[model samples]
Target: MTNLLSTSNQEEFGLNVLIIDDNEQITKMISSFLDMSNYECTVVNDGKEGLDLIKTNQYDSIILDLAMPEFDGYEILDALQRENPSYLSKIIVLTASNVPIENIQKFKELGISSCLQKPVDIDQLLSKIIDSSV
Candidate 1:
């Protein structure tokens, strides 16, 4: 198991992040990047598990994928909206899907901070996280 946070900078800025995606590669890649950047990260491979963690833990941000088996990102979003609206402010949707403009607008209405397409630009994502953390 990977260390969730870097002790090197936890005292200064312990940003905890949760990454929810069915793609193992994507989760690992993001986690590695965030860990190196001094952010604590927990990766979940399914939406259900992700939802559970969100309910029970505290995180500064969430990186979510819209497509997954067992429970898709929409369902997770809906659950958060209904059961824990505050979480909406911390989510950043990261999906490879060519989502419709209407759907993207709806996601914004649901209070997601941002919707980013896959093959994510690491610098942009890091910037978004930093901006949101403030």
Candidate 2:
């Protein structure tokens, strides 16, 4: 893990974040913003690829989208829950779907740090990443 010191003497650190979204444009946009913020961002366009990366690597934070053709976000979450429950705390769900409140609550119960509906405010995502990394 890389340690990126904050601008202040308090010494906050930036994290390595993984972004799993099928939308290439969205991934590119988020990756650009995160790169500017000093967080190491790795993006994948397929859910299966994202899950494979998660299994093989360690990430301080994850920005996940709920919808995908194969191996959707839910599957990724389930795998993480079964294999690495602790990692769930680092997740930030970013979905464009109009999911029910109950499902949102379910995700929260599974230990996701936050669930954001797209088009997510980049500033808010940055803030959440900073907070979670600490």
Candidate 3:
């Protein structure tokens, strides 16, 4: 478990969080952490299902993975950019791939809150979640 002692935020609870990742372990770990921290979490390991959920429900924060087999994160992002641009503020990109600076800049320009590399510290991820939801 992450050392929650390092987080400075006030007590928080019941934030609706959606985690969309292809990796089961990653999603499980995050969902477990969020649940332990009193967040309402929904996890989808399939990119298509994740996109569907995004279209149908609003979330406090969205943790998105860049790589998936069928319907990748970029496609979801593009769809959101066209249909619901405001949701961009709630998006936090989590990827292991080495994204070029220009693409990272593009994600920033598109209003993505954070583009964190994989193996991210759970505290840092929580911080990004807190900051972006605000």
Candidate 4:
């Protein structure tokens, strides 16, 4: 079967992606890789900023980290889902936390599109984005 997650099809797609992560290196890396694609990326180092950005803009996807000060990814997700369910479908959690089965269930309940564990696998991240767009 053909792998539908290939980036070859992404040329026709134009997306605005928000990446929320506390790790500077990871954020830069993810943004760099994503920028090389057809997507526009805006990265924030904390949940509060991420939340604020989400409030002000419409993003095709959100790559959120589970751990952060003040507000966590879950909190942001909850707030976004409460305020706008349409955006909820675009969220993808990028976390290093050992997300439990129950938590995963909760993520699903909150309408998270996908959850990626860190240290981020670039190929997997790209694949997820491609799959999501498709």
Report the number of the highest-lDDT candidate. Answer: 3
TM-score (C-alpha, index-matched) for candidate 2: 0.87
Better of 3 and 4 by TM-score: 3
List the candidate 3 regions with Cα displacement exceeding 4 Å.
1-11
Kindly give the stretch of ten consecutive residues in candidate 4 with the minimal lDDT sum.
1-10
lDDT of every predicted structure (CA atoms): 0.86, 0.82, 0.89, 0.79
Model 1 residue 31 lDDT? 89
User: Which residue runs of candidate 1 sit more than 4 Å off their true CA positions?
Assistant: 1-11
Ranking of models by lDDT: 3, 1, 2, 4
TM-score of model 4 (CA atoms): 0.85
- Candidate 4 Cα outliers beyond 4 Å, as residue runs: 1-10
lDDT tens string, model 4, 1-134?
Answer: 33333657776766788889888998998787677765789999988989999899877778889888788887887787788777766877878899999988877886668887887667687666656544
lDDT tens digits, residue span 1-134, model 2: 22223345222345799999999999998888667656688999899899889888989889899889888998999988999888888889899998789988888888789888887766687767766565
Ranking by TM-score: 3, 1, 2, 4
TM-score of 3: 0.91
Which is the leading candidate under TM-score?
A: 3
